[model samples]
Target: MQTEYDVIIVGGGLAGLTLAGLLGHQGLECVVIEAGEKIDRVDSVPDDPRALAITHASRNILASFHAWQCLPQDRLACFRGMQVWDENGSGAIAFDSTELGRPTLGYIVEQAVLQTSLEQAVRSLSGISVLHNSRPCDIQWQDDHVSVILDKGENISAHLLVAADGVQSACRAMAGINYRVHDYRQRAVVCVTRTALPHGEIARQRFLTDGPLAFLPMYPDHQCGIVWSTRPAHAEALLKMTEREFNQALQAAFEHTLGEVKESERRSCFPLRRAEAEYYCRERFALIGDAAHSVHPLAGQGANLGLLDAASLAQLILEAGVKGRDIGGRRVLRSYERWRKGENRIVMMTMEGFKYVFENQSSPVPMLRNRALNFANSFIPLKHTIMRYAMGLSGDLPVAAK
Candidate 1:
């Protein structure tokens, strides 16, 4: 029951745990406080219908913490290519790993699998601890450190307090940080399905009139993870449909790209929104993962962005420690903010732009977008550039991500 550490991470999710592992391995003492049951034991992770798209860069960061290695090979699927097309018109674009001189474009993994592996990796590190079923009730900001008061009457002090909590981050609110959320007016219906035809290890996205539908390949050739973003009313209707009806609707929406889609797992839904904090850090406080920002699932970049935030912040903190400087100092934390804020904002805007262009059914706009897609597809240089950027292979990336 150590009361003090170099860093106290709020939220033992992927981002927080990843930070703990990175810092602990570099000789920094860290503790992760989570308001959930302890999940460090083997097979303790719960089931989740949500799937995450892990870019090559994100994989590198996880590999640095050795979490990627802990993942079961059978639970992971590599998508060697992606096919995107618009259902409104005859326009489509495709990206392949061969074009980028890579073996695979990225990976599709269950959210629970990723979190479990990351938590296990963090737990194995020497100077890191996880305190589950613990909630932070208050924060005492100091000149060089921060003290967190837990609901269970525990006081934990650290040089830095990083909020890796989810979208409604209580830590961010408690720290007086303001955030902006833009509701997409849609809900993403997620589930795992088995298709009549094999997925061919490729990911597919179709832009419908209302929103986008993505079929991400999962383990086993015929299985895929489905993210169908649509209006609330439509989403509710889909949820209420019979299994057979839902399968037919899904198959029709996807245009049978992989043949009939059978509901192989329970379905779930969540609202889609783009949220960002006004500032990334204040004094000894900082935000990471969904705590700082949440993007549309259209591009499947939320988890990847959060993982990058963790890596970037950890790198900066380790750099400050090596120089004998206060890792929680305003200067060090601001550096992390400056490094990721704009980059994340760009991605958010990109997602918004994609949403607007497709959702706009106005005359000429649809035709123009279709033309744009085709034009981009035929242009090798532009296509490669988009592939690199989307896959996170090109950017001012963190050391671990690179």
Candidate 2:
């Protein structure tokens, strides 16, 4: 029996494509099965309505793949500072990159930009191929390898299989992985807002009794990516508002931090939920990105966490190959699982803790949180440590990120 590939990654997304690029760079044969043809050319995807906070480690990984260079130089905005506060109390804390001896904290970017870059890099690299307009209908796991059956009757077999199919992953479902989903009873309303004032290269978030509202800077303009998480009923009402009316509400939400939300794209909303798979991997299989876990978007660490998942899994697989061991072996996959799962869990829980603190702004907690924020702000070392973690520079990261 001949193994067709070293890996067959389902869902040609940020995690899968990045993993393919890394493994391909190492001379491993890999195939990425994508659901749509247009996904292969993500540059054509409109740059509208959404953005991500790319961490420093994620940038390094992209740079190693030569994908970072593909992003438009002018379309990148680097934020040097972050300010987070409570709407009901004086619990305010600010972080500056200068304190951490770094020029910037993170880059704000559009997902389309990253998708195009990763797909392009994967295509250029040797030993990796993407099957566009292809979707896997079934997965057959054997003692030695796994075979993916495509809807088009195509068969792809590999020593290892990875699921990067997203939060509601079909692959995860096939694997019988139990997902714990907690509904926040909230919806995240997002849009591109043309602010009256310049963003000044800062990321700002204000936590209200309902939820958190974020203003992330965008490139080459005074535009901000606004992500407002609130109750579903409130989100419905907000979504029903006229553009002018919505911008007015947006201005009120931020309390005129950027003056007025003068112009904005058609706003959209998605239900908020926290989900985690029972395990990150099983024999001959692994999960990455949203397939493995999803954190609250309030922290803006979702994709950053996914990139690290890709890097760490690839690192472990490559190491297993070097030792002449089965890369898809349970032990090899466990090592990757243990590392990524733990980190993702810790981050998710921390976000939950923060969310709870913000959502329950009763009386005593508000005063306590205010004091905690002031204390954290006044204490330079503690603030630097927190900022460092947010920058993705504080842990045992893969070589690609380093």
Candidate 3:
């Protein structure tokens, strides 16, 4: 029997929804099976506090699917500058958008807002079907199609199955894809706070011996979202502190740069681990987003990378469809895997290196990092290259007409 759709996505988060919208825009018939009760919105924001540092490339991809404009402008904070410093009190490097001839390097957007926008875009698409509160209990691969059994005993099939189900992806596990995980022995503590001084459209990250502490600018003056990574033991102690104590520690860690700090939202912590699948594609399956690769949050490129993956995969399917080729063919899947795997591996390794170099307590390592930062700041070409990569402009981008 013929399947009802061309593809079945087993997650409704940003990656899944974004891909659904993109494919639907190209007139592809797809269905998204989300385990959650409903699509996440501002009110349904998860307790895990985090924000997205969206680059121009990601914004362009979203805009192509009409998802970018759907977001509230006021909720997005355009950061024109980014500063990285060594906590050893040696040196700091800053990148300004003006120097790169760009209005803004990127925007610091709340994860909830981004998810909400993608969800709405998916909801409005005629060719995309969304099944909420449905979990995949089992999966069977046949020669022509893959069958997914929901927890409710309903069976559905599709030509291809997309695993955007996040880092601990069930689809990836079911497909027997081995994962190599590197535990960083660090935990990321996220929260929101009010500052005495304005952030001035600038985001800052201070690399301490323990981990990296980043302040992402948000809407309204004197407001920013904080992601402070530290050893698991220290993170637990911090999480146990009272609101006043937590704010005091936070202010001190940031050198009181923003003056008095007040906690504006609940705090949350998540363990940091890096994971990459042995293979991004199998016979009739593919992995996207965290399911395929996850890296350190110090660079703030995790979500951006996932969005790029979705965009690239959608482009491959659309182009193949136009050329009268099977979208789920192993040849097409392999092409997508080849293009993204290397790029994702490089990012993971880069983040791992940064984590090691900056988090080392050895006095010599601090001096070395300080010297590297100073050199990077003084060299125009090197600075431009780093900025371009961070903006997602220079990389293995999808082969699609801009």
In the range 1-402, model 1's lDDT, one tens digit per residue, is 899999999998888888898898788999999998876543666867887889989999999878899998988999999999998899999999998789899999999988888888888898998998998999999887899999999999999999999999999999899999988899999999999999998999999999999999999999999999999999999899888999999999998888887665788999998899999999999999999999999888999999899999999999998899999998888899999998898898888899999999999999999999999999999999899988998878999999
State TM-scores per candidate: 0.98, 0.97, 0.97
Error of 3 at 189 (Å): 0.4
Whole-model Cα lDDT of every candidate shown, in order: 0.91, 0.88, 0.87
Candidate 2 lDDT, 1-402, residue by residue in tens? 233999999888788888998899889999888886655454476544668899999999888878888777766789999999989878899988888788999999887777877788889987988888888899999999999888988787999999998988999999989889999999999888898889899999999889999999997568888899999999999999999999999899899989978899978787888999998888799999999988889989998999999999999999999999999999888999889888888889889999998888667888888888889999988988889889999788998998
Ranking by lDDT: 1, 2, 3
Clash pairs for candidate 2: none
Superposed Cα deviation of residue 356, candidate 1 (Å): 0.6
Error of 1 at 192 (Å): 0.2
Q: Specify the highest-lDDT model's number.
A: 1
Off by over 4 Å in 2: 1-3, 39-43, 46-48
Which ten residues in a row are the worst by lDDT in model 3? 39-48
Best by TM-score: 1
Steric clashes per prediction: 0, 0, 0
Which window of ten consecutive residues has the lowest lDDT sum in model 1? 38-47
| Model 3, span 129-191: residue lDDT tens | 888898899999988889998898888888889999999999999999998898989999998
Q: What lDDT, from 0 to 1, does candidate 3 have?
A: 0.87
**Cand. 3 TM to true fold:** 0.97
